[model samples]
Target: MVAGRNVLRALRDIRSFRVVVLHPADAESDELVAQIRRIGCRVELIWPPRDGIPDSTDIAFLLFRQDALTDAILRSLEDRPLAVTLIAIVEAESPTVIEAVVRSGASAVITKPIRAFGLLTSMVLAHKFSTGKLISAEKMSRLQTRLSGARVLEQAKAIVMSQRGVTEPEAYALIRERAMANRSSIEAICASIVSTGDVPGR
Candidate 1:
C-alpha cells in the first residue's frame, strides 16, 4: 500500500500500537485518554520520564509546557534511535519552540484541548511519516556509499593508468580481472591498489 494513504480508511483500519504519553504529570484530559483507549492502543502515561521512552513503545505523544523541559526531552530522544513516532502537544507556540520541535524530529503536533479524532489522525500521520523518513534515510546512505566507492575506484584507475601507461578501458579491465580472481568487488580491488600500491593477485 502507498504510504500516507492508510489514514483514509475507516477507524477499523487503525492498528493497535503501543502509545506512550510523555507529560509533566500523569493527569491527562479524560476525553483524550478515553478516546485513545477506544481505539485499542495500549497507552502509558509517564511524568518526568528519567530514562526516555521504553523500547516497546511505537508512538509517543510529548506534552511540553516549558522550553527547559522540551530541551531535556529532545536530548533524551537523541541519545539513541528509538524509531518511535513523536507527536508534540503544546499549549502555546513560538518560533523557537517550533524550531526545537522540528530539530527534535517531531512528525506531528497537536494543540491543547486535544480533540479525540484529531489525536488519532496525528498518530496515524506521524507513523506514516516516520516510516517513510526511515526508508528514505536508508536509501540515501546506500547511495552515498556507492558514490564514495565510485570516487575511490576512479582514483585507483588513474593510479593504474599513470603507472602502467594503460588506457582507461584497459585499467578498468585489469581491475575487473583481479577482482574476479580474488572473488571480490572491483571497488575492493581498486581500493587495494590505491592503498597498498599493488593490485590483487599480482
Candidate 2:
C-alpha cells in the first residue's frame, strides 16, 4: 500500500509526453509515429545521428542494432537522472537482446513490425515501471532510517540499564516515558540519550 498510492498518482498524472522516436524512417515506423502525434504528444523522428547525443526528453523509443544512436541517447538519459524512460523497439526477442535492452536502462520494449494496438500499452508500461522503481528506492531509504533508529534505541536502553541498574523492560519504559514527555519520537529521544550517555529525568 505504501508504494501503491504513489505509483497510481504518478500514472494518473501522466497526460501528454514529449516523445523521441529513433528508427530508420520507414512506412511502418512512420505510421506509428503519426499515431503517437495524434494522441497529442509532441513527437520527434530521427534516423540515428552521426556524432551528437539526443537531448533529454520525457521518453525515448530506441530501435535495436542502432548501437551508436542508442549509446548517445542512453548517455543523455544518464546525465538527466530519473527524468526519462526508454522503450526499446526490437524485431525479435532473445536473451542477448533483452539483456542489452535492460542494461541500457530501458523500462519496456515494443516488438517490431509495430502494431498500433500495443504501442500505447507499451508507453503506459514504461511509465509504470519507472514509477515503481522510484517507489522502491523511497521505501528502501525509509527502511534504512528505521534500522538506524533501532540501533540508537538499543544504545540508549543499554545506557539506561547500566546507569540505573534496571531491567531491560524498565529501561525501555523509562525511554518511552521520556519520549512522551518531550513530545518526540522514541528514536529521537534515544538518539539524544545515546549521544550524551545518560538517561534524562532521572
Candidate 3:
C-alpha cells in the first residue's frame, strides 16, 4: 500500500509547490528571497508573519529551528485555512518539541542541512497532497480504511456511552465490550465493525 501510494504521488504535477520561507532577515531578507526566486518555483518571503500568509503559499517552512512555535506565527498561518507548515530541524531535536509540532498540525519535517533534491521532493509531494491528488489504488484503499475506522470508532464510542454509561472517549471500553461479546481481540473487533458493519447487541 505504501509503495502504491508513493507511485501514485510520484506521478503528480511537481510545478504546483508554493513555498513560504519564514522568519526573514533584515537587509539580507530580500537578497535571500532573490536567490530563492532564482530556484524557479513559487516562493514567498515574509517576516513577523502578521500581515497574514500570502494566498498562494500553501507549504510554509521555518528555515531555522524554533524551540516552540509562537502564537503569532500560528495565528498568521491559521488564517490561510489550508496552509501546511513544514519544519526544518536537525536530527537531535527533543521528542517533546517534535510532538508539539505534530500536535499543532505540521504537515512534514525536513532535517537540515537539506539537500536541494530532497527539499524539492518534499515540496512537490506536499503540494500534490494539498491539491487533492489521491492517485493510486493503494492510496484509495488506505483512505477508505481510514474513513471507515473513524466512523466505526465514533459509533462504537457512542454505543458504549449510551449503554454502559461512559464518556465518549472510552475507546478502551468500547473495544472491550465489542471484543468480549464477540470473542475477538479489540483490534479484530474494531476492524470487523469498521469493514463489515458488524456491531454486537445492536
Candidate 4:
C-alpha cells in the first residue's frame, strides 16, 4: 500500500515536468508526444536540432540518426548547468549509434517503434539517474572546495609559524583569532594571508 501510494505520488509530480522532444515531426515523434502528454507532462517538439536546450526544459528526448547527425545536435548535447534529464532515441544498436548515445550523456534510451510499455519506466529511471549524478557532482565539488581550503589553511599556518617562530598549534590559534577579529571565516583569512603573503590586521 505504501509503495503504491509512493508510485502514485511520483506520477502526480511528473505532471509538473516540462519535456522537450528533439525529433522531427513523424508518427514516432507524434506517438511520443501523445504518450508523454497522456502522462500529464507538458511536451514541446523541436526539429532540425537546436544548439542548446530551452531554459524551461526539465527533461529532453533526443532522436539520434547516424546519417543525419549535425554539429548543432552535438552542441545541444554539450554540458549545461540545467538539471535536465536526457533520453536517447535510436533505431539501431550499431557501434556508431551506441557511441552517439554515450556522447549525448543520456541517462536512459528508447528504441525505435516508441511503445508506451517502457516509456514511463525509462522517464522515471532516467530522471532518478540524472538526479543522482547531480547530487554526486555537488558532493564532489564540496569535497574539492574543502580540500582546497585545507591546503590554503595549512599554507597560512606554515607562514605564521615561520614568521612568528611559533608552534603549529599556536599558528592555528593566531589564524582563528584573526578570523574572529575580522568577522570572517578561517578559510577566508587563510586565503588572504596566502595570497598577500602577510596576515591581515597584524
Candidate 5:
C-alpha cells in the first residue's frame, strides 16, 4: 500500500492513463487516485462485468485480485486489438503461472512485494512500449538513406575494383578519401561514380 505513493508519482507525471485496480483497492490505488486527480483519466475500482470499456486505454494493471480475473472479461480484452499490454504483480510467479499469464495476453509479469520503485518503473516502460509504435517517416527515412548508401558503396566498390584491379577494401578507402577531400558524403560521391564511372566534375 505504501507503494501507492510511487504509483501516483508515476501517474501524475504522465499525460493520461486508464488503470483498473482490483480489490482490495488498497493504499496503492488510493495514492494513485490523488496523483491522477487532474490527469483526465478514470481509476476504475471494479470487478468484472464491465462492457463497452474504452478500447484505447494506454495500459492495464492486474494486482492479483480475483474480481478482475473473470473468464468472460479476460476474453473480451484479449479478443480485440485493444489487448496491447497487461502488467501483473504477484507475490511469486511460477513458470506455469508466468506462461499462463503471458499466453493470456499479458505482455509483462512482475514479482511483488512491490518495492523500491519496481512497479512504477515497469508500468512506465510498458506505457512507452505500447505507445512507441513505429511507422514514423523519420525512422523510415534514415533506414532508406542507409540502404541507398550501402547500395551506392557496393556499386562504387565494384566500379573501382573492376577498373583499377584493386581489392574492395582499398577501393572503399579511396572513395572515402576522395569524398572527404571534396567535402561530400560518401553516398553522393559513390552515386556519381556509379552513374558515370568517374567522379563528377573531375
Candidate 6:
C-alpha cells in the first residue's frame, strides 16, 4: 500500500512537466497527445522535427524513422544533451530501427501503435534516466577539473622548489600565502607561478 501511494505521488508530479511531441498530425500522434494530456502534462505538438527543442520543454516525444532520418532530427538530438528527456516513437523493431534509436540518444522508446499501456512507464523512466545522466556528467566534469588543477599545482610547486631551494610543503605554503594576499585561489596563484617562473608579490 505504501509503495502504491508513492507511485501515485510520482504520477501526480508528472503534471508539472512540459512535453513536446514532434510527430506528424496523424492518428498515432493524436493518441500520444491524448495520453500525455491524460497524464496531466502540458503538451505542444510540432510536425516534422525541428532543428532544436523548445527552451521550455522538459520532455520531447520525437518520431524516429529509419529512412527519414534528416539532419534536422539529428541536430535536435545532438544539441540538447542532458536537457530534454527524449522518448523515441518508433514504428518497428527491425535492426535498422533499433540502430537509429541508439544513435538518436533517446533515454527511452515507445513502440507504436501508441497504446496507452507502457506510455506512462516510459515517460517516468526516461525522465529518471535523463536526470541521472546530467548528474553524472556534472560530477565527471568536476573530477576532471580537479585532476587538471592537481597536475598544474604539482608543476608549480616543482618550479618554486627549483628556483628557491625549498621543500614541496614550503612551496605550497608560499603559493597559499600569495593566494590569500591576493584574495585569489591557490590554483590561480599556482597557475601564475607556473606561467611566469616567479611568484606574485615577491
lDDT per prediction? 0.79, 0.77, 0.58, 0.87, 0.63, 0.85
Ranking by TM-score: 4, 6, 1, 2, 3, 5
Ranking by lDDT: 4, 6, 1, 2, 5, 3
Task: List runs of model 6 lying over 4 Å from the truth.
Answer: 1-9, 68-71
Give the backbone clash total of model 4. Answer: 0
Task: lDDT for model 5, please.
Answer: 0.63
Candidate 2 per-residue lDDT, tens place, 68-176, comes to 5556655655655465777888886777667678777788888868888877767777978876787887899999998998888889999999998999999999999
Candidate 5: stretches off by over 4 Å: 1-13, 27-42, 64-70, 132-202
Question: Which consecutive 10 residues in model 3 have the weakest lDDT in total?
Answer: 83-92
True-structure RMSD for candidate 1: 2.8
lDDT of 2 at 93: 78
What is candidate 1's lDDT per residue for 1-202, written digit by digit as tens? 5543544653444556887888755345555666777888888777777888998888888876656776888888996453778888877787777777778788999888677767777777788788788888899999999999999999889988998899999999999998999999898888889998866687
Candidate 4 per-residue lDDT over residues 96-200, each given as its tens digit: 889988887889999998899988888888887898899998999999999999999999999999999999999999999999999999999999999998889
Q: What residue pairs clash in candidate 1, if any at all?
A: none
Model 2: how far residue 133 lies from native, Å: 3.9
Between candidates 2 and 6, the one scoring higher on lDDT is 6
Candidate 5 matches the true fold with a TM-score of: 0.45
lDDT of 5 by residue, 101-144 (tens): 66565655666544434555666767645544333445778899
How well does candidate 6 match the true structure in TM-score terms?
Answer: 0.91
Judged by whole-model lDDT over C-alpha atoms, candidate 6 comes out at: 0.85
Error of 1 at 117 (Å): 2.7
Per-residue lDDT of candidate 6, residues 7-54 (tens digit): 787677778999999888988888889989999999989876545678
Name the candidate that leads on lDDT: 4
